[model samples]
Target: MKKQIENRSDLQLLVRTFYAKIRADQEIGFFFNETITDWEEHLEKLTDFWDMNVFGTKNYHGNPIIAHNAVDKQFDQQITSNIFGIWLNHWFATIDELFEGENAEILKRRAQKMSTFLFMNIFESRGKV
Candidate 1:
């Protein structure tokens, strides 16, 4: 029986770890640099997003497509793909590091599904596939 993560603090740590990886990665760091005006607020919003998604907290209501579309409008497909890939990679890595049992598996599956959806959206938007 693995311990269940039942609070926002655990989720915040996961988000922070994911962003640390994003900041360190050369290929995707520029996206963070260009898009995030206030890093702390961005992290908080992201933590809230995950809290809502993973914990059903109902704390996040931001439009993800609009935000990503804005960034996609600025950057090309390759950059977007790199960003998404690194984003999912770091996201799942953080989850795996900090969680266990069904919770970890759930996060991993959700991240993979989101990555696939983002890739398909990118491809469809570009009329590539």
Candidate 2:
């Protein structure tokens, strides 16, 4: 019996579950596993981010664009759409495994949009286009 993502606890579950796959994935795990030193703190921040994203709260203030750009530079711009694709795949799989209903669907759509937007920005930040 899955449920809607109606609260912070749910978002926490979603973020934690989704990131587990990301951290374990062979193709993209190194990007996160190496960069994020504090899993507990990072998970809390990500929970806050999803809370603000889904619930219109203001608990999250970190700039994803800057963060991602720095990651790209740190890895010599190795980040690619295939990596984002893997990320999205994990996100969608995690959501489907945990919950259902409008919030579940909304998270999928949001992830899709964010991946595209982030990749574009990452590409532009590389100064290649």
Candidate 3:
């Protein structure tokens, strides 16, 4: 396990790589293309998101649930699942590749919990459970 705090570069790299994968993925790309026009703004927002979540920088202010709800209104469940799955996969893979330590394990667990919470909320919002 590697120290998570020392892997801020890995965090930024992972985020950028994940978004790159998303942009290229056919299933999820359409949603991104449709919803986002300014790449710089998205990247900044994502940086803030990661900073707050992983670094305790407390920079992210946007509501993920609100964003997901908007996406859900426009896209179907399959697309949403595909996006989330790929995002999680890339994120975890990046962490595994760049860091290994107790902090990394904690980060992974936190990410999983967040993912589960988001997915559960989406399902509940849709009255699917």
Candidate 4:
């Protein structure tokens, strides 16, 4: 039986596993390939982010929208809705593999909301407003 994400370790595992897939993906990998020189630090930040998201821990503080906007500028706003779909697919698959419970479900739902919010900011930046 899969366990519900109940602590920081689980969040770390999920963040790491999810990013490993992202780093290997041919399409969305480039967004992170060159920019994130410190993979360990990046993973730590992501762990904190997910930890806060899933567990309501207050350890993460960063403007994700600003960060993704920079990424969009780097690739000329190529992070389309389809790319976000791929990201969410990987996230759901990772969560399903390691977790099964209300918190796990919350993780996916929060990710969906986050993706939409971030993408909307990106679209606005591209004059799609």
lDDT of the candidates, in the order given: 0.76, 0.93, 0.73, 0.91
TM-score per prediction, in order, is 0.84, 0.97, 0.77, 0.96
Cα lDDT tens digits, model 1, 22-89, are 88888888878877889899989988987777788787879876566567767875545666777887
Best by lDDT: 2
Model 1 regions lying over 4 Å from their true place:
1-3, 80-83, 127-129
- Which sections of candidate 3 miss by over 4 Å? 1-10, 76-83, 127-129
lDDT, residue 19, candidate 4 = 94
Ranking by lDDT: 2, 4, 1, 3
For model 2, how does the per-residue alpha-carbon lDDT over 1-129 read when each residue is reduced to its tens digit?
988889999999999989899989999999999999999999999998888778988989999999999999999999999999999999999999999999899889988999999999999999979
Prediction-by-prediction clash tally: 0, 0, 4, 0
Arranged by TM-score with the best first, the candidates are: 2, 4, 1, 3
Superior candidate under lDDT, 1 versus 4? 4
Per-residue lDDT over 1-129 for candidate 3, one digit per residue giving the tens place of the 0 to 100 score: 444545456666666776787778766677787889998789878877776776788778999887886677777665355567876776677767767776567767877877777876777778768
Give the distance in Å from residue 84's predicted Cα in candidate 4 to where it truly belongs. Answer: 0.4
Error (Å) of candidate 3 at residue 77 is: 4.5
